[model samples]
Target chain A: MTDAIELPIAANSDVVLVRQRVRTSAQQVGLSLVDQTKVVTAASELARNTLVYAGGGRVRIEVVGNGARGGLRLTFADEGPGIPDLELALTDGWTTGGGLGLGLSGSRRLVDEFDLDSEPGKGTRVTVVKWAR
Target chain B: MERVPILKLGDVLIVSIQIDLQDQGVLALQEDLADAVVESGARGVIIDISAVEIVDSFIGRMLATIASISRVLDAETIVVGMRPAVAITLVELGLSLGGVRTALNLEKGVALLEDRDNARAVAVPR
Candidate 1:
């Protein structure tokens, strides 16, 4: 059975909520402390980006399991002005705002699986997963 | 508006971040710490992050920025009580917390700062 949780990312405080939820869900799946922290931190970065860049959005946290492994997945969706250059946006130290610019690239490094899709005029959806070891 | 309180301990400032900080809270902390350092003549700032369970690139950058600001005001910043998980996550997040000192706990952090102060005093011969 898969369990999922949804959180609205409307403000800075919501970012904190997303982190808490991610941490709890990661812990529920028996992920290691390090793994839990990684997912929580990644959730925070993405949630903040959803608010700061996208103005507001929603995040869905889910637990997935195959026969061999179980993992945590998070999807952040936003209807804001999307990125025009995916490559540049994924580059380290690249920011369109006054931020550290480590949100996208760093989050990708913390998880086992990463996926990002964005359109110039439509919206952006980011999905990340961390498998239990 | 949420604010992180800064407590003055002798010439050191102890900021225990218990609440999950938002962007404004972080910005407020930077401002408050900078002011406290200048107003109280603090020579060391100890930030206790034991209660902060999650730290992303933004919080990591906030720590580095605070350290930089404190240093410019002649104060050394030491981040303490970072959990093992947090340490691993921070490295993976690609934030080295450049130029920021760290300790295992508050006692060690304070001792380290005192050692630095003593060393500075000795080196200055004053």
Candidate 2:
């Protein structure tokens, strides 16, 4: 399973398209419906966050797995104003926009693995993984 | 997406979900909504999602959360208008709504609730 999906997040709609691609790709590689849905959901959330919070962004979902613990790794990057305090933003009930502030933090709950990186004036990138047995 | 609120069939409140259905607001709304629906004295609820283009694990979980609250409040919960594409995406992605009820569309979902209320109304004749 060596497929990488990359897309620019200029509009909110693109998030849906890219997430669909991830779902298809994961299923193509023997990922179960449940596993595929879990990852796609997380990926879609990241994509939307990039579009809304980051102004615009892109994504790359790579398959990284071994045996029973196989999983998908999603890399979401955006060029918008990065989060000044990643720790505070990760806190529940804390949001800049009207949302529940669960885009970054909530998405983390769906997958089995999570990692995020960002810098003010630079950009933000989030990575997530969902396991399949 | 347009929201079409179904009125007066019974104690059931059906709110058409016709937006992005993304992010956290949906999550918090689920909480407030369950309480609101229960507080509104509704016997059941149906959320239309035909216009929704995308769904994630969080949405699935949130839907389940809504169902849980509804059950605790003694109200029925139903999800309507699930697109085939979205369903397939969720299936392949391994995302599931857990225990929430689903319908082909809002009309069917509302019918279920209305049917229940209609039955109850018939049983309690004035």
Candidate 3:
């Protein structure tokens, strides 16, 4: 069975909410403290990206189990201007905003699975997953 | 708006962040801390983040900026009481927080500041 929670990502406060929910879900899946932190931090980065780049969107967090392993999966979907170059965007130190440019690449490094899809003038969707050891 | 309280302890400034910070809130804190450093002539600033569980890139940059501001103002800044989880996340996020000194807790942070002060005093001629 897959259980998911949907959180709105319109405002800055929603970023914090996403992090908290992600942490709770990570803990519930028996993720180690370090693993928990990594997933939550990734969620925070993606949630912020959704708010800033996508002009606000929604995130779906789900808990999944595979045999003896359990994991958490997060999906961030936005309807704002999508990225034109997914390759350059994934490069470190590349940012369209006045940020440290660690939102995309850094978050990708923190999780076990990552996927990105964006179409210019359309929107962007990012999915990441981290499994418990 | 929630504001992080900056307390003056002798020639040091103590800021304890007890709540998760919003974008505006972090900006306000940056302003307030800069003003406090100038107004109080504090020689050191100790920030306690034990109560804060998360520090994204925004908040991470805020800490680095605060440390930079304090350095320019002739004050030392030390971040203390970071949760282990936060530390792990910060490293994975690739924010090394360069130029910022950190301590395990407030007490050690104060001691580190004092050590610096004493070393300076001993090195300088009267």
Q: What TM-score would chain A of each candidate receive against the reference chain A? A: 0.98, 0.89, 0.98
Cα lDDT tens digits, model 1, A1-133, are 5999888999788987888888888988889988998988899889989998999999999999997888999999999999999999999999998888999999999999999999987989999999999
TM-scores of the candidates are: 0.96, 0.62, 0.97
Task: Give the poorly placed runs of model 2, Cα more than 4 Å off.
Answer: A67-69, B1-54, B57-112, B119-126
DockQ sort, best first: 1, 3, 2
Q: Arrange candidates by TM-score, descending.
A: 3, 1, 2
Q: Candidate 3 chain A — worst ten consecutive residues by lDDT sum?
A: A33-42
Report the Cα RMSD per candidate: 1.3, 7.3, 1.1
Candidate 1, superposed: residue stretches over 4 Å from native: none
Model 3: DockQ vs. true structure: 0.76
**What's model 1's TM-score?**
0.96
Q: To one decimal place, how large is model 1's interface RMSD in Å?
A: 1.0
Worst 10 residues of 2 chain B by lDDT: B1-10
- Fraction of true inter-chain Cα contacts (below 8 Å) kept per model? 0.96, 0.13, 0.73
Pairwise TM-score winner, candidates 2 and 3: 3
Candidate of highest DockQ:
1
